[model samples]
Target: MLVDIGTEEGNSWLGHIYNLQGFVQFRLGSTEDALSFFNKAAEAFRQMRRADDGPWLVVNYGNLAWLHHHLGDQAESEAYLSKVDALMKKYPSPSQDELHAETYAEKAWTLMKFSNDRELLADYFQRAIKMQPEMVEWNTSYFLWLVNTSEHRDDGLAANILEKMRVAQEQDPENFCLAACYLEQRGKKREDVKDEARELAVKVLRNPVSSYNGMRAILRVYSNYISIDEAIALAEEALELHPDERYLKRCAALCLKRKIRYFRDRHTNQSMIDRAVSLHEEVISLYPHFSLVKNIDLANIHAKSNNGMAKADQMYQDLLKMDLKPAEKQLLYNQYEKYLNSD
Candidate 1:
């Protein structure tokens, strides 16, 4: 409309439209078209002396940053984001809490994607949260990011973030984001407080759909603390909902292995052995790579209580017959030979 009416800065409006159009195209997965439009939009914004005030300037910068990042042009992405960051600092955040929080949140997101600097992202997110502490999502994202990089430094930062996350949850009950942050913090500190972390995992499992990280946290917890029965039940439930979930399938396989080990002393029970065999077969079908981890372990599992060395040998031989990589073949051969020599 601005262009049609010959209004002042009408060309600027076209650039804004192109920028928005580019964003829409990107979301729809038209990378080439999106980049074309973004480039055009950025050129126009640069031409417009008032580009700083151009509606699409910030958004265009962000979109271009993403496009460049995906294209593996990390330098270009950082440069693009730096432009926006400079403009943002010049303009500064709004005094209003909501608007201030939004500005900081966007800055934090750009920092997260554009830089590998963990401390910088943590600072941006913390600033955003302080700007509007009501923004539970920002707090959660920060906490989770901290968890991912926790292995890098032990500045007690993870614990501090977790403490803040706990407070956020207290302020905002039913906040799955906060819950996820809390669960991850607990899971990473599992070395000292396994039981507590396991309990937290059970709670997280009850609502795994909240976030993928939360679900993974639950799986890790169950791996350590839960009984095989409980783990199996949960894995079955997860598979029922998402049959194609490879991670859950792996967990199920591990749980079945644990169950077999559990019932080893109770071998008088045939049902346990049958169930373990069935689970292992299911794992082989779902995750063939997992079944090839080691030949002896595979033989032991496949040959376990029923008959004798014959069944185990056959299973091991069948594994060896497969197109094993040299490394895999060596591993299996070593395991098979070791077992043979042991008895």
Candidate 2:
């Protein structure tokens, strides 16, 4: 649909669509196709000849570099990386940071996926927002991160951030900022925001934005503010759209676990626990280095269900053997103790 629209309307619209397609293809592991789409996107940007638009091409070049590296073509990867450096130098952004908003957003997102450094992730997100304050997705992401990190540490700071997010939502009524803002309010247990948050969740889920980040933002709103069932449903819809998106799969699994936890009755439904466990297993199989937190959740579910106790014990032992940080180990022990104590 985006391609069809782009075909009818030539210009920066086409360039942006091609860039999105490239990212989607890259996520789907179609490296060669992604490279072709990125090349076309760059050509489109060059044809447009917008001074500021050249900086936008940095993401395409960076993605191409990463894709080439993954394909074991070190020379081609280096060439693309060099091209990105040249582009940054040739078309410097107004921030003079040597890195564009796209680069910062990409780094922030990658860190969120694979790294445990929330402070660094927050820094990158802040830089992206500073460079492109008008970008709704960046604002939403930064706000979410602020809320996550500061919810218990500093209520005053979190309130200030929420106010800023609320102001941003008011300025751009149609963007995803409203979703994030209302969701934050809901997290504070404010009854006034519940209806608005639900409305925004439905609105975003019905007509989500075109970017992967946009989809993830929408999913986050659903998972955090909306019902767990709704979150799982929205995740399933997203996975149907982007079948190879591991993030969506992970989100779905997390939502399923949340749903299970919502039920105080451990014997509510055996099938539900089974489905969540299966999803977790699938995630571990697909990404071996994935976070073990989900595995801990799975073990807890098993123990609560009074089924697969042996497997749960084995999982707990495996987690203990891994070299985890002191905090992480303490968290695992706490969760295990709770699981053991649960009726």
Candidate 3:
């Protein structure tokens, strides 16, 4: 009915339906589809000259900005955010509590992306947090932001953030990634964090291989303090699930590299080194665009494994053939010369 009546006086009502549909799509993670509907709604607003006349336009622009940012189009996202900023300036602050909370939350997220001002960003996050304390991702992301900032790192702020995340997790049991991230950020030395990270990684692994995030958590747990056998087993499981995942392959390769060097059994360890080389080659083959970095790693791994200078030189030559940023090209050149000088 909405589509059938999309023209005439019915067009106004149809536009609202499209706007709501776009919002629903955004919430469901169909961002690209949401953007298409939002664009249609935006055109309707433009044709009706209603862009500056309603609160709906304000939220619409903000949603568009967020969607564009997720799409990796920062320039387009900023442009839409500028529109929201202008709209906010023209309107008086709403008396409604919900509107106030949403306004602060959206502004806080936007400001966090806009500037390097930790103090200011923290203030905004705090306002948003006060409005909705149970929003775990927002709180944890802000907390991580604080943890990464120079002033907050030495002040035990990450610990406080971790505590908040813990409480949030208890309230929301399904938030595995959030729990994994919080535990991962807490580092691996503490027994509590290590146990939690291991648990979360196990849960995450059982779900899907497409989750780069879950794989990262599992890798970090093994990389820091887990036993060689356990780490190797987990890596094997992950590789079986996600064969084309370069990051997971890299994680497995790194573990093998360390195990090969550190273990008491020389013959058994050499097999591990050979496996790491093979995994690195698979990653390189799958992601040729990153050949420069991949080949460098492969060359280093071969050199360490006593593969001799010939194979290493060829890997370096392959890296140099690609179009590279000046710094990347220079780094590869320096390494190549060092390899040539090696006996």
TM-score of each: 0.46, 0.61, 0.57
For lDDT, the strongest prediction is 2
Question: How well is each residue in 80-161 modelled by candidate 3, as lDDT tens digits?
Answer: 9998877766664545444544455545555554467767677767876786676555565564455345322323345555
What ordering of candidates by lDDT runs from best to worst?
A: 2, 3, 1
Off by over 4 Å in 1: 1-61, 64-91, 94-116, 149-162, 177-213, 250-343
Q: Which residue pairs in model 3 clash with each other? A: none
Question: What local distance difference test score does each model get?
Answer: 0.60, 0.66, 0.63
Q: Candidate 1 residues 93-135, lDDT tens each? A: 6554433454556556556544797776777777778867765
Q: Which tens-of-lDDT digit does each residue in 41-113 have in candidate 2?
A: 7777677545435666788787778878888999999998998889888867666545677677767755654
- Candidate 1 vs candidate 2, TM-score winner: 2
Clashes of 3: 0
Better of 2 and 3 by TM-score: 2
Task: Kindly report which residue pairs in candidate 1 clash with one another.
Answer: none
Candidate 3 TM-score versus the reference: 0.57
